[model samples]
Target: MTAMQRLAGFVLVLGFCIIFLFKDGRSQGNLLTGKTVYVWDFATRDGEVNSLTGNFTEEFEEALIQTQQCIVIERRKHQRLFEQRQNEKGIMSLDEISNAEKESLKSLHTNIVVFGDIYDDTEAGQLRIGISVQSFEGEILTKTSVLMPRGKKLDAESRQMAMKELVQKLVSGKDPRPSSEPIVVEVENVRFELKSCKLSGGNLVCTVVITNQGEDRELHIYLPNTRIIDSDAEEYLVKAATIGASAGSAKLVSGVPVKAILTFGTVA
Candidate 1:
């Protein structure tokens, strides 16, 4: 064989070997090596845990572990590390950790941080737990919430089921529910006059009148994250609904008002 043919054969073999190595490395990397997730102890909005908060955290960690997709840093471990860091910094209490410090902690070599709060819904006789998973940079990746109905006692089974659902949704990256929080922006000379808001069969129906108090101007309303807080301070997530008037494309003349009906769903 000619020297050129031998050289071409060697080059072809080298290219095939390189491609094989690259493909193998990519497959190995894609395997479930377990993402490092840290679960912070959930705070209770109504005073203390009352035992439910602690158990919920454990269940959350267990769910992640069972998925074989996460290496969970349990609450106890996280507490110890937090305390150690506080001691090193001469901080006396966990409350002393500023928001910036907390954000820094969440970003510390962790792939995901799961944190949230539990609220006692006194009127409904239930416990509302809101869980959010965030990236190291503090961007929320997914949020799932659950409500455990309380009869005469705390329903442990219901809580477990909620945790399982949350974990499954988190792993699957599907959120059927809308956001619980609202994105509020202040527009000069434009005001929202809430007409009426009522909860009817697990949904909150609300009507608001938007007025252009200053000058004639075109206005757009995008309220994907809009929420309604009841008299009891319970908040519901707003669902997408058609407003009778085109709120998103309303051209309001001076002193004119546009009435829009808004609907929100109860977060479970």
Candidate 2:
């Protein structure tokens, strides 16, 4: 065979190899990356009410306080309930909650809801979080959450950090007080394509087209970068994509298609 033919053959075989080996991994990672995470927010329904005096004797005041207490208590209960559900039934979203309870919870808060999931991965060595936020009217608010993972070998602190970040993202909006960071994930560009792929000399290259994607998560996209792809790409691929890094996640802003490039190749 001619050298040109050999080169072509080599290229084809190398391309196939790179794609074959990493294709599934890439697909899985991207699938997870492009996931329409149903960030399940704990439903909220209660008129905002605060009293420094703790004075409440009217029936309406009693009911309001009871309603607020129920909201907080229910959150605790949900912690256990959702934990159990996750163990036995898999991750639970607020949407999975019974309709009756949904209505009841809806009556508690007209402005906020909480929902999310924590994913553990040993390969990426980090925790992945996906959250869904919805309004009291049952409309999806935001289906984004930050990922937190144990950066190193399994240790108590790493595990604790993961859980802490997970919880922070899950319930960051609940607190009226300001937080160092917010919980929100925005996909600026979601692209998909199949093209020449190869792994040579320790470098892998696969060109990818940037698709229109991203959420205007103002302060919330600062959560640790989740391992969407285990490749030779820099972490900034995800971080630098944003205009600026804020300390927290963004609020749910919808109706806008995340700017995405329809196609692109992978290079490593």
Candidate that scores best on TM-score: 1
Alpha carbon lDDT of each predicted model: 0.53, 0.31
Each candidate's number of clashing pairs is 0, 57
The digit string of per-residue lDDT tens for model 1 on 185-261 reads 22466655544433343244555566668777654434443454432345655564333456334566878766656
Per-residue lDDT of model 2, residues 48-72, tens digit only: 1223111111211223223222233
Model 1 regions more than 4 Å off:
1-34, 47-50, 84-108, 152-155, 174-268
TM-score of 2: 0.30
Model 1 residue 160 lDDT score: 74
Q: Where does candidate 1 clash, by residue pair? A: none
For every candidate, C-alpha RMSD to the true structure in Å: 21.5, 19.1
TM-score of each: 0.46, 0.30
